[model samples]
Target chain A: MPHDDHDHPHALLPPEPALRVKALETILTRKGLIDPAALDEIIDTYQNKIGPQNGARVVAKAWADPEFKDSLLNDATSVVAELGYYGRQGEHMVVVENTPGQHNMVVCTLCSCYPWPLLGIPPGWYKSDAYRARAVREPRKVLAEFGVTLPAETSVRVWDSTAEVRYLVLPMQPKGSEGFSEEELAALVTRDSMIGTGLPKVPS
Target chain B: MTRVHDMGGRFGDGPVNPESEDAPVFAEDWHARALAVTLAAGSLGQWNIDISRHARERLSPKDYTRFSYYEKWISALADLLVQSGVLTEEDLRGEADGGEHALANRALKAEAVAGVLASGGPADRPSNVPVEFEIGQEVVTARPAANRLVDGGHTRLPIYAAGARGRILMVHGTHVLPDSSAHRLGEAPEPLYAVAFPASELWANPEHPQDEVVLDLWQSYLEPE
Candidate 1:
């Protein structure tokens, strides 16, 4: 009841979907189909523990160390498992690199099949109708909406995850970041950058 | 079987409104709860991932386009539970089952949740069968008659890519075939390839002629061009 004390509008009535979810949870829990504690753990695991930060570390290491990058580009599943970022939607891994002449973006047109272990749950836009329908057909236009503009000569490669293997775009390291530490580079890796919707932030 | 979920190159959909990079993983509390419950139910091993996906895809076109993402998930989860005999409509309405149903090896406990998730389901399987296609081979996707295949059960073959010619980019090892797997037929591990289809092949006037759409397709979905 105390959680209802909010200043914002729509605070009084829980949305329709919310009530439906609550009812379903109650029914399942009552029927011994699911555990309440396990539910808490699942939420906590994705909500806090597993997220884009794990992927940022992977991207940062790839940029900081060429050897690791080679291994990552070659055998992403084995190398990322070494870093303890493996499981679920990321059972099979493929790291696509972005060069000056080429860019790689990822989408699952059939469904929202994302690399949950590496990048956590996909953003709302990644799962929306527009993204699923348009990303494969007109990736450049979709990228522009995400504030990314590639040159005319820079060919865009849109990866539609129609199968098990998941894709992570390794954005090209920004110029002037030659001497930056891995930690600094990780900070520059945004979730969208890895998803190929936007570029990694340049060192400030 | 070519439902709304197979929408790839259909036109007139609006802009992709991506959220800020730091948006919360779950926009609302119920969304998190819904996802967690669906996943927890999934731990029972009553159905495979492909089966669960097919459940969602099985949504009628009207309901498929109408419901939100989690809404579809929870709705499908309910259907799965009923179909699996894990729950009943009477129980869903809060009526007592009188402890009649026997459920064992079903509880995905709090302690095991982390380990279960970390040791996630792996779809890859060793295959004695020879791979049919190789990288750089010219291939064309299956042009399903009447937009359905595999007895119209469940398929990962999107409609747009069907009949489009492409060159194999990379060959992923044998992986679970969703078409048969979704129907509880068998894993039927098959060689999967990341085929690179030029935008021109899949669309009328693609925004960029040089652009390519690379899709990871199973062997059955493709044939020699």
Candidate 2:
């Protein structure tokens, strides 16, 4: 709850100095103050030590056993712990099931709220003003833009997340993953699949 | 119950800007210092507390938004120091000149990232003043009244969901309040609703009329359903 959202005393908010802001950030980078390579390190550290990779592990375990999967969907925190992604934010996560009849999309209309520990760095569009404003009005259209066109008959339910519950999509397992190891199956589970867009097609 | 970073379980569908964003611009002199301040404030925020209460606040609307993600943090730190009598501008300059700035505060800088503010959009731009409401309350979504645009003020309220209805799902924190982000906007908005919008209310003649979707709506953008 920021004061700025309602404190501006005008109609449509004032446009910010976008160009100026960009120029200044460039200067900060040149000053050698920020480790130019720090971003890559951050991404790598999270991807390897934390992030969606851990989430995939959870998904893989669930795919291999129905009991475990049910535990994951019903009580994600403890089940994920059994798989060993401890202390990360998913320690208390909730898995929202996406079945054939329905689809779920996540957005933070108020701000750029996200689950970074489980998902890694959020995509650029996740923080865009356009996506935030449009996701609410035209979710299906946005999903379609991401190449996640659903059957016309299915219902699209957009979940505008506040700071309440974090969401994860349980994508259907691919056909060829039957004999794959947990690591292999984990690889097949793309971040997009968990976001409820493209399904994990059976590995050819 | 959820933190800003734990967005996965809440949103039913795709991730919101599920990726990192390009650092927005800020004035050069203010960038690093502002980042320090914001980082200190963020560290406090990790516990869901506002540090502004204990610290002297010096951030202007322009400086707040102008700062990059980290820059806001630095400025927040500096402001806190001055306010709390821990350090002064002269001390900061002396430390910088004596080469003790970074070395004396590496741990502090490391901890600066803890509770970054989730405030989106440019900090300088005017924000919407969310109308008052509670979660689960019914509301109607409508476009902004065309005539409210006046003088230099800005509104965070977007005109996208004109003539829509929803239920109050959340009451977020208050920041720079926008006087108008909706049609028939009241003077101020509080408790912005993280609402669910049916796909039908958004698009015309949806294949499934019963299917619904939810979106966050500022109190200003809605009316009683």
Candidate 3:
């Protein structure tokens, strides 16, 4: 039941952000404005239930099944919804496939508008000013920084998510991943790969 | 009009320092609380997501960048609470008496959190409005005059893409325009498009001229070229 008493005249604590948040929660709880349990529930949902793994699963499915890939590419909203990953920022989904000749990347230059239902909260770098400005201007260089060096002939198509629609990059399937199971393939798909900042883990 | 949030192609920002893959979802407890409070406040349904975005963008240019991501959320939440008569400065400062107040009618419960998160609020709504443009059509983005750098209010059109010529890759069905929806002006649904601007057009001396940048643009932002 401890709360940061900001009113203390000579308080020792220097008003840390965590303490301030707790103070706000305490006030709201007292005022019957917010439920502490509900707050914990929301925190748990984002922390556990939703995340990059969801997007990775979609990628793995698309990689394993061509029909699913076509459906995802043609109607991402319906396909992604069928998998129970449609919500909020991801109402209208667009799946951009990454081929050998074309590499796709996504960024919300105006603000960090990411597919929360698919990828959870965006990574710090995705929301950072540097990536927002540079991704659209110099995607190839940015890709290289993420250890995603493309061939000279390959084209990097950047999608600046400027509106309500969200994008998911369908990274190229790595060679030798042919016999892998869906779960195994999902494990190989990293969040950055789906964001077009990195590549899928190659089979050893 | 060239709002601080529309930072597409401008340079001299900084470095792109990405976090490692194992980074925790919420860096701190406060980060979680900030999100929870924002969502809880938003559940009241007084304002839509667009309005909430505007609240964040309305922060001073210095303050907008100065605050961390969730810190921006907290500031916007507080701003909306006061603006919507949900709370006052005294309530936020803990100066007001903590009298029992009526809880919001639509307070989200802990049990409903998972359900709500799973079934997100889809923005795609059927509109009888006929489409004005078609796929494969060449179009030019409406360029705001130099003196009027913005569309007068909250807009999804990035200044960098302004005046650029592009081809319509797809004609997305009628969707609510954020510019109007955010301000509560009206639904003002319009046909959105996936406009593909060649790299050469968006940037001079492009590294890969064959590459293109696609943006989800509204019909009002474009004109047949």
TM-score of each candidate structure, all chains considered together: 0.94, 0.55, 0.92
lDDT of 3 at B29: 80
Better of 1 and 2 by DockQ: 1
Off by over 4 Å in 1: A1-15, B98-101, B145-150
TM-score of chain B of each: 0.94, 0.36, 0.92
What is candidate 1's local distance difference test score? 0.84
Clashing pairs in 1: none
List the candidate 3 regions with Cα displacement exceeding 4 Å. A1-16, B145-152
Per-residue accuracy of model 3 over A73-160 as CA lDDT, tens digit each: 9999999899988886788899999998999999999889999999998888998888998899889878878877889889888999
Model 1 docking tier (incorrect/acceptable/medium/high): acceptable
Query: What lDDT score is found at residue B173 in candidate 2?
Result: 42
Misplaced by over 4 Å in model 2 are A1-44, A86-92, B1-41, B44-197, B201-208, B214-225
For model 1 chain A, the run of ten residues with the poorest summed lDDT: A1-10
Candidate 3 - CAPRI tier?
acceptable
DockQ, candidate 1, comes to 0.41
Residue-wise lDDT of candidate 1 within A1-204, one digit each (tens)? 001122211111234777878877877676676789999999999999999999999999999999999999999998999999998888999999999888999999999989999999998999999999999999988988988889999999999998889999999998778878999999999999999999988776
**Judged by DockQ, which candidate is best?**
3
The TM-score obtained by model 2 is 0.55
lDDT of 2 by residue, B1-225 (tens): 111222222234444333321232222434433333333333322211123311112245465435443333444444444444444444433322323223232322332222211221221123354356766777876654222443222333333345667666544444322433321233342444567666666566554675676554445556787
For candidate 1, give the lDDT of residue B133.
85
